[model samples]
Target: MNQTKKYLVVGLGRSGVSAAEALLRYGAEVSVYDKKTQDEIEAPLVNYLKTQQVTCYLGTDPSDLGRYDAIVVSPGVPLDLPFLQKAKTLDVEIIGELELAYRLGKGNYIAITGTNGKTTTTTLVGEIFKNAKRKTAVVGNIGIAVTSTALVAQDDSWLVTECSSFQLETTEKFHPVVCALLNITPDHLDRHKTLENYAKAKAKVFKNQTEKDFFVVNYDDPVAYHLIQECRSTIIPFSRKSILEKGVFVKDNRIIVKDQSQNEIDICGVDELVIPGQHNLENALAACGIAYFCGISAEMISKTLREFQGVEHRLEFCAEVGGVRFVNDSKGTNPDASIKAIEAMKGNIVLIAGGYDKNSKFDEFIQAFDGKVKALVLLGATAPKIRETAERFGYQTIFDEKDMGECVKRSFSLAEPGDTVLLSPACASWDMYSSYEQRGKHFKSCVQELER
Candidate 1:
């Protein structure tokens, strides 16, 4: 936080750029480094940073680790990299864009983190905040870098941030007034290296939260709930299962928030929510818990839940052709997430899956089908592995396609009337696309083309 200290930003992505810009604006000496070359990473932000005379080390490693006071790393940059390890050895501070933003910004943050439903919950939280007439900004892994909004955040503002495990990993003194952990499942194991390590990263979201602050937790998830046992925050829980004496939960088809006195405030009916899936119901519960603890009205929370159309690429309806409906769930980039997507659909699904593997096992995902999935269409790097898993499970009706277009066409052909052509890849899209957004957009376009 010292204005005169020098800072280094690793990675040239959005978070990296925002961190670099924020440091410059804080009157600190700033430098940037990325494994990608200059031409490989270019945007108005990158060009603007160059105009600021910011030092950039592109397509190369930093030679000296001791020059900068701290390194602000992007979520994608591995902290175990050689130079980063060297920096750690020299006693240099290492933090992420989220930490930097927390230090620089002035706001009450409702930080949401989990293996799945983060985007949906964060979006719902933002909507609830907006409905309450609070000054709010939606940032972090929901797409906008938190640092980009850091300077403008006032003390009265609310930053409804979507914190990823990667962002949470580097947090130091990054505290949110309301922190929610939706659920933790096997995800990003390729980066974190283990499920418990991944859970540890998620557990950091509530690390700095004081008892005065509220920590929203998923009581139904044993893995996530166990980690919160040592948390210092005033715990607020939401569950799809047992009825709690306090916090938000569903009972008799209604979303209810109970106080210490066992008084309940009815939010809305479960069937009234615009988004689908039991997972989404959990997301709504978490959001409601966060908003209620933050002083948002039950009416506003219920209204927002009823009106939320859901974020794009997450169970989004694309088109219907020849009685076959197409759904885009590109955000289902892990097995646990795809399983939720599968459970949300109605009719028999001809599913298009497979992408970049994150060391995820597809056994649970495949088993979730339970005769609901009619056929499988595979693509991307994880295609072979997924196909093997599917065959071993006795779901042999599968077709391996070279690309998204072929996969979409094949899935549509395999679907009968009243069936859903669902693109719910249980792997990340890095092997075939820059991001899940790019992959989802491509799937939607291919489906739209079918109508043409």
Candidate 2:
């Protein structure tokens, strides 16, 4: 945080802009770069940066890269880019936005990372800390930029951050007082390229932590359980199945936590949670474990668990039309996430699946269909790929839809009374929609139209 240090922020995204602003605020010379041209960037942000006197490099490689002391990279920028590779050779000291926030921010941090339940767990932990009267800020992949929040963070502030594999990749000294790896599954394979590499990136959340720090991990997930061997922090394992001598687990339908002191405390009943799904129960456990390590009381954690309705786009209830219920699980952008959504439902399901293929295989997703998925309504680039997988399983009830509206309508037609029409695309929404939120909203609108 030296006043005269020069910093280069790569990418003009939210994280990039926030990093640049934070560096400038700390009295550092800042330069911004993005692949997009000046016309492609937002006017307000462009004008705002101008007022700060930060140099902007658009549609080209940053000039005089060797002059900067450090380069802060946004999560979306690929590390293998030729310019970045060249920068690495020059020993420019590349770090991610999370690392930048960590270096400049003063606060206790609780970071959560996983393939499926990061947002739900991070949000739950944030709520639990707030319920305990702690000054908490929820940031990172959940939405808010950590750099922006970190700038104003007081000494007593708790930064509950949701870290993704991409963000974790470039981190070096980004340690959290409390960290959790909810569950590791095959996701972002197109980016990380391999499962081992992805898990290693996620394991970075605990890389800098000492024995004084606490690390929460999923005992149920073999991939996550394996990471325990690599972590340096005090391990707290959470499981939906089996009793644990340490960490959080469920017993006789109640959430139980066995602290570091060997004192077991009953947090809440499984029935008390407003959110459905065993996966959510696991999320709740991970959140509770984090909160417990942070000194939040069990009563406060339980209260938050019982009242928190769950995050949007994760098995969110859309509406009921003609006795068929519609659920939006657009957040299930990966096979494992969609599998959890399918397992959470009660009645027969007319599943609307498929989207932009991330080079992921769908055999496991197709196998999960079993008896619950009465009919499959497919769409987007992955439709044909999913159909092939479904046929391999000898499951034949399938409908190919051209759009989200039609996908919903087709799912409804295939659904009977007491059946659930679930929009749990096992792929990302980028094929047709900008994000999963937009896709979920459009699905809700289509369902609402059916009600009319």
What clash count does candidate 2 reach?
Answer: 0
- Residues 62-161, model 2: lDDT tens digits: 8777888999999988899887888888889999999999999889999999999998988888888888999999999988999999989999999999
lDDT of 1 by residue, 191-298 (tens): 999998999999999998898999999999999999878799898989988899899998999999997577899999999998998999999999989998898888
Please give the clash total of every predicted structure, in order.
0, 0
Best by lDDT: 1
lDDT of each: 0.92, 0.91
What global local distance difference test value does model 2 have?
A: 0.91
Clashing residue pairs for model 1: none
What would the TM-score be for candidate 1 when compared with the true structure?
A: 0.98
Q: Candidate 1 at 216: error in angstroms?
A: 0.7
Model 2, residue 36: displacement in angstroms? 2.0
Best by TM-score: 1
